[model samples]
Target: MTSRNPWSRPVGRRSVLVGTALGATALLAGSQLRFAGRSRAEGADPWAGWQPPVQSFPNTFIEQNVPIPMDDGVTIRADVWYPADESGAKVPGRYPVVVTTHCYGKALLGAMADYSRYGYVVVVADSRGTGASEGSFGLLDDREGADAYAIVEWAGTQPFSTGKVGVDGFSYLGATAAKTAATRPPHLAAANFGGAPTDPYRTFITQGGNWSSSSALWFALELLGVAPLPFTLNSYGGLDVQPRNPTTDIATFLTRLQTDGSSIPYRFAELQRLIDGSNNFDNGFWQERTTDVGNIDVPTLVYSGWADLFLRDTPRDFRALPLERGSKLMAIGPWTHYSLPKHIGSRNDQPIDDLLISWFDRWLKGIDNGVDRLDPVLLWENGSERWAGHDDWPVAGTSYDRLHLTGTRSGTSNSLNDGTLTALPAATAGSDTEVIDPLAGVCSRQTVQYLGGLPVYLPIAFFMPEFPISEFPGIDQIAPCFRTDDRANEQGALTWTTAPTGTDLLFTGPVALTLHGSTTAADPVWVARLSDVAPDGTARPIGEGALVASRRALDPARTKYSPDGDVVEPFHIHTHEAVLPVPRDAVETYNVEIWPTSWRVTAGHRLRLTIDGAEFPHLLPNASTPDRLGTLTVHYGPDRQSFLNLPVHQGAFP
Candidate 1:
């Protein structure tokens, strides 16, 4: 539900006069001088009397529905907001323009007004097939990019425009801005992208071919909220447990429900069809939507949240952009999908707004605002509530240290050092194994309030509270982990270790796994989790990575790995999906790549790595079956050295 504004009613002329008087006093006191400036050519500030701060401006909010004609002759409906005084007295030749593309919910009048108050001619348009726009909304498609370009060009020619265009928004809007930048529209000068998904297959919808359960649920809710009339929960079954009435439109609601799994039969039909249609990582679909970061020559500011679902994608975009432009800046904070203006950490509410103003000042007004001289990247590190600027991301001067595992066992004599990564090894033959019951779904740590009775599900909610999965009390009832004091127990889980570091270490980038063992089945799935063990014997989950074995082939163009026979390699596996087989009792090593993360394991914190068969919530439970990875007989040794390889950055910022 949206927040209510008690002061939303129109103010009388007397009230407006009083408000203007107060604003004038503040301007005279030099509080809003930064925003009051004279036109370069005229040498006289047109807005000198309008010295009201952005927050207190007497905005004449007007929402006009206009049919924006695209190149294809398709007209998209846009809700345009401009100062009501535009047609009144003579104003500056033209005003700077900012365009916003709506998310899955389409454009709203209230949201559009919020941007118009910022002193720009704001245009909010419904993507094709959404809201009042023509054509079918096929999620993210080429048509939307084309439409954005058309809108920018149209805005540039309008009488009220200064011919400078800037685009801003999050998620889909962010992606649109990225795509528009790549297109290199003549009028598009700058952009602000937040929580944008760089690679659809790698970051959005599915990661490593595994569909995000939370994302799926969110899309389902969107469908329910937007569908037109007669909202029915009958087909959704238990979904009705939560009631939501967002819109009276039946078509919008039905469209949303059509995206859910419960209506799969009538919506998607064959499971393989849905998967094949969305398996666009290597296909032409994603290729068309993918942005050419190297081609985005315009100034850009990218924002992301540490806790955001699209955190990974935002960083990827920042790293991929061309450095020569020197125009790219990144701002990340501790926040989730919905929380903006306020964050869990850092104090930079004005960073987004200030960045926009400075960007426009330099690009549109040709004023030197020192924006180009700002640091290339700014990130918010957790535990520290301040912003840190760097010449590049993944901070320079990082090094990698391998932690080797060593222990004795109770299970099979697979005691060949098992070469797995770990601070120590198991000591027994019978280690720990947990059978996860899918019926009792795991609870997540992340939650969000919405129009529906239910709360939004987040990935953070499923993190294990303690180390040694066996120690988790909640798992005992649904899934149990095998336990043994024996450090050599190599039956259920694989253990790896690194030598204790005499000095502190900082590492960033992707983590990898190289396994040298065979399983009884042709297809197998394994999971690897990296953690830090404190001297106090407490363990905390730092970073975790997993991959479905069927998709093990590495994309040579994007893969990075160490040359040492250690074999922990990084590969972008989106190019292909291959089936790998293991002969029974045969030692065949498999190199696995995990997700990326940044961390500094202090001198006293032992870098502990855990190799397990499953990770609940984050990943689906690995049910051992003849059809799956087959009966597994795992082994590890230095000759077949299986370890975690980390990318260490080093060097000073320019």
Candidate 2:
């Protein structure tokens, strides 16, 4: 059903000659430029202190039920917001169009009014088979990407359009922008891809080869949103039958999907099939859905948060985009997926819309605002609470510092400080072992105690508030009130603590755990976390990484090697092409890449590494059943040395 796209002609990118008109508008506008207020108590708003300028637009008019034709002949529904005057009449001049497409209907999108009022035509479209659109929805199917491109081209050709188009949104809409921009749409002047990850398999479904319990819920939500029934329609005003050829059956496909959804366990089974079937490599299925960042040649703006689920790959993809230095921008904020509004609301800042307007103002409207003159990297250091800009990520002068785990295996249960993390390795061989009940980790406690475990199967809409399970990202845990219980440290975790830092230690890059260890089971999963232990003993996680023993081989093709030749991929090892399973009861040196972090461990704060068998709910427990309990042994010695490699900014230390 692939149709030749007439508008698919590639548009070569112009050499954006960014003039040196640097403005005083702080790239990441914040109050202070110090290192003290970085880390917030768990659940505190990371964006509480900073205030960004709020840009508002006036005279917006909404036009609903616009039928956009895709190459596959499906009539996708869109809500177009156009610039209007106080007399309730359309503004005469044509303006650049910004198209935001998602499975969720247009009405839920709040940004449309803002963009439209500011003299741009904003089109929020419901992809085929969702909301008011036609065709059965296949999540991330190639057709959706094609539909996105068609929608953009359709908008570009409209009389109200200035023949320039831009795509923007978060999550699904971000993904739509990525796919559409990759196609090199002739009228797509720029794109703002935020919160949507470049790699779905690595960042979304199965991170580190470990499945998430929330997969089934995601599948159910997708199916529920896409089913043909009127009841399944998204929040796009209402479920009105479109005037165009009205042959849509409201009950048939809806009943089928609902019947399928009734067996919640089967949904998980289907999800597992996709994970296992892919064998964790970039297969046809993943490649079809994933955006080839290398092919994206537009002036793109990428955004992510330290606590956002899709946070890992956004920066990586931003670096991959084939745009000129000044053409691409990356902004990493402090709020989680949910707390973004709270953070922005606390400070009278725009909810990522200010940056969007500034970007669009420069690229689409041809405004010579100095946004292009600002540094490409804008980040919020967690503990420091200050916004900083840099020419590149892992800011210029970062160096890797390794902390060695030194101590012996002692008590039956893990003590808060069973082992020490030291600058020097143990003089002699030292080993520590801990028994793990895969289903009995930190997340399990929340599921069983805090919110009933039923949230695991319920739709996110039904229980996101109490469920606390936000897919792999876990945005609920970002609240200033949310702190990991000390009980998790006692339950089957091998703890390694360091002497309090005499002076502030600024760690602002990728982190990794090199483990010379062995597990009793063949299919063991290792969850590791790097935490900041405050002077008062409250442990807050700085970053976390995991590994599934069976999927340990690195895929050199997909793996991005460091420029200096030291192989480091922040967060997770980009390994998938080959499956090198762990030999039972054998010691292997695993170079496990933990997620990246930007934090400062102030003087008197100690660093800790807790290694456990599982990070439940966040990741599905080890494939092993309860009967096959496994014991993991972490080895540290001259022969089998293990350490946590942290990217430290020596220059930032005061």
Candidate 3:
């Protein structure tokens, strides 16, 4: 199932390749083990500060442009950060290695360096082709995963290393880390990463077979060794660059720029072919790209947030890991991609950095630090702002509750028709209509999420009205008013609202939306959003889902069903054989899988379901017919009622 060329050797012809060839065993053959301790540490922890968590080494040193050779003689390069003495010289002794791969040309993802001072060797590599490494850039390709496996093993077996390795990164790098972990490399001790989706096809490139323009564009530009200016915003504090890692210096950068000009066009062509062909399906090329964390055979710490773009997969990834593989942990906090480490309320009590440090220390250092005894799932409840520990994801006490749509008005938002959402079906059949809008979801938090949190701190909040600005150097730029507030984004949508609940209702997991409706066009796009409407009628989006009607065929085996046999999570078979045609006049059943969320709708707050035609820059319809944009008709009644399925719980998650 692993794709390998077994013959493409670009290292021989690469004009800009840096670093020298060294075998795994010979990498540190001449190096000798050296031990040095702090003047104040005969029996005490010297680097300890007023900080709650004590430190290890006083400083760190970088060994730039270290070569990570693959079996076929191709060379991958990395920058190694070694624990240092007070004077800042590499303390050469056996330590565990943590390898993180990046597609950025330079030291873009530098947060990995911070772990070096914690007594572990941290190695950051530029993934093949994107940086100075030699090969055609394979974005999330199996070959790249192959490269990650090589990097880990190479860093592991070195003389200065203890032959134990862990992988780290977020988003793109996180995907590569997951792949590396899946390979089950012998030296792979653990994996600590975040913001990764199991299937890149679902959120990164396409959603329910709907094309996501912004993320796709961002990655395309990155393959060319360039990035959108917006992506350069705060990176969870990953800005510490270590001098000139061959690929980062002025001379090598100019040369790689030239290489990108000649190579990226072909890369773009390759990506387009996949989009135009069978890769659009869930099982072919996408199957290879999907991260099967189940294949992982070691301890892992998968970090995520309810507000992340890939929220649906974070908990899913945790649930998939085999219990036979010792201990693993998943932390779901109130975070966006840029607000990655910004723990909110109960989460702050258990700092994210502290959790990561304790995890790696326990696994890599062979320390019995008792982190394994921590709850398998650490979650932050939104409205209540309380931390809850659970035995597993989806929580033990969760029960799927269905709420049907009706034509009666709730008088909530000023959407096309403020239809009613209820626990029971309507007595009589009715339909509400709304004209299709091609440009939607731009003025919402989704804009920031899909952009990888691009404008999180940018001062242009007024220009976009979607990004939060409160994080930007203590600037009160009206960002607090827009973070999840979705009134502007849903103005053109057709909505169904639930009357005020008698008590609090907690939605703690994946969500599904069923639409028994029809569109005026031959092919249509369905965008569904679940929002919490306060007593003041202010609606804030909680979760969202989208589907291209043509790819709506479901795979029964993989779909999740409730105890009552209702579909809780619809798994669609997106192959060409499964594609269905949309007739303008006939009503069809369409199910949209909303990304997971953890939020509470209070007693006075109502729940609103909004249906639109597009998510704009975030997603575009992938229709065969060019003129598929049309009006939508949502039907509600005992026979043809559409409804929203929620993962509801009454009290503590248990």
**What digit string (tens of lDDT, one per residue) describes model 3 on residues 50-142?**
133347887778776677788767677676778999998988899988888877753555443267778888888877765556655666778
| Span of 10 residues, lowest total lDDT, candidate 3 | 1-10
The sequence of per-residue lDDT tens digits that candidate 2 reaches over residues 1-654 is 001111112122111112101111211242111121222233344333333333334455666668887776768877777777876567777889999888754544534226866678888887666666766665666888888888889999999998989888776677778888988888889988887756777776666776654443356555544433322223222222332222333432354355443223444555767555443555666666777878887799988777666677787777678788779988877755444232322332444666677688788988766667666777776776666666666565555545788884322224533788876767788788877766545443223212212333234557454443322333445332234544355445788888778888877766767788888876677778767778767776666777777666665444433322223553334345455667767998676767777888888877878887766666654334342257888999888778776666532211
* Candidate 2 regions with alpha-carbon error over 4 angstroms: 1-59, 86-89, 110-113, 227-282, 342-348, 408-417, 443-481, 484-487, 557-566, 570-577, 621-628, 651-654
lDDT of 1 by residue, 553-642 (tens): 665445532222233334555544444444454656556656555555656555555555444444432222233434444453434434
Displacement of the residue 345 alpha carbon in candidate 1, Å: 9.4
Which candidate number has the best TM-score?
A: 3
Clashes of each: 61, 11, 0
RMSD of each: 17.3, 10.4, 14.6
lDDT of each: 0.49, 0.63, 0.68
Worst 10 residues of 2 by lDDT: 1-10
For every model shown, what is its TM-score relative to the native structure?
0.68, 0.78, 0.83
Error of 2 at 443 (Å): 4.6
Indicate the residue-level lDDT of 244 in model 1.
Answer: 26
- Between candidates 1 and 2, the TM-score winner: 2
